[model samples]
Each structure stands twice: as C-alpha cells, then as structure tokens.
Target: MRGNIIVRIEHDCQDLPPERRSDLVTRRLRFLSDAEILDLASRRERQYPGRNLHPVSITLPADVLERLQRLQGSRWSVSALIDRILTDSGKA
Candidate 1:
C-alpha cells in the first residue's frame, strides 16, 4: 500500500546549513513525491529512447515560432517541428 502512495527520496543535504537544511530537504522530497512529477517522468520515459539523434538546424519566422509555442504549449520545440515537417515532406 505504501509503495503505491508513498515515495522515498534520499538526498545529501549535508552542504546546507543545519538551520535551514531540513526544511529544504523536506521541500525537495515533497516535490519528488508529487503526482505531477511522477506523471511527467513516466510520460517522458515512454516518449523518448536512450539514443542521441543527430541535430539539424532550421530557422523559423518569429510569428510562426510564437504561434507554435502557444498552440503546443511546452511540448513543441522549433527544431523538433522542423524535423517533423522535413520528414513528412520526404526531405529528411
């Protein structure tokens, strides 16, 4: 039961001064235990594989960039979108 609902995090807070270290460590641990963190981590692991892909550079109009950044929220990167377009267009 504890395994599902509780998360244990081990950190070395030794460098932090004794007066504030425990509070800092507690906050950090609470952040780790958050549902949002777990969900994001799990989603990221499933989405990306553990290999480096070659990088390609592309330029975008400022308006285009702004629009895409707005539409896709935080999931869109200009480079990724350019690569996706190039691939779909049989140019990659």
Candidate 2:
C-alpha cells in the first residue's frame, strides 16, 4: 500500500503586490503529479489497516460545552463524572 502523494514545488520566484501586508499569507500553489498522487493514496491504504476513510469536522453548541465545563469543576471533575457513570453502569 502507498501513502499520500508528494508534490514538487516548481516556480520562478517573483515579488508579491505591495498591498499584500503579510508574506506568509501571500504564497503560490504548485500542481501535483498524477503518479505522486497515486503513490500517496497507496501509502494511506497501508498506514490505515482495514479502516474506511472519512473526513469530518464537528462544531459543538457553545452552551452545551459550557455546561460540560461547569460539571467538570474541581471536586466533581470530568474524569470523575465518567468514572461515576461507568461504575454505576457496572461496566468497570
């Protein structure tokens, strides 16, 4: 199996516009080769054994997170809450 493709950077260096304040923000993008892309995909298959790949990002509700934090205070902490729940469930 192969990993993600490795693209080469090839560009004739040039100066950016004066209006662009940050050098970091002003950057050029290079194209990736097909073979390199295939190699990368193959490598990924090997690295992640028997795993179905899926990309994901989650945004939680602010109030819910705040409530969770409130419950996670000094004495009755997050870990404690988890332990208590698990123990009460007779799983631990």
Q: Which candidate's lDDT is highest? A: 1
Candidate 1 TM-score, C-alpha based: 0.36
lDDT of each: 0.33, 0.26
Candidate 2 residue lDDT tens string, 56-85: 111223432343344433334333232232
> Listing every candidate in turn, what is its Cα RMSD in Å to the true structure after a full C-alpha superposition?
19.2, 23.2
Residue-wise C-alpha lDDT for candidate 1, range 1-74, written one tens digit per residue? 01111111122223434334323323333444334323332312225455345433223334333333442344
Off by over 4 Å in 2: 1-66
Which ten-residue region of model 2 has the weakest summed lDDT?
A: 21-30
Clashes of 2: 8
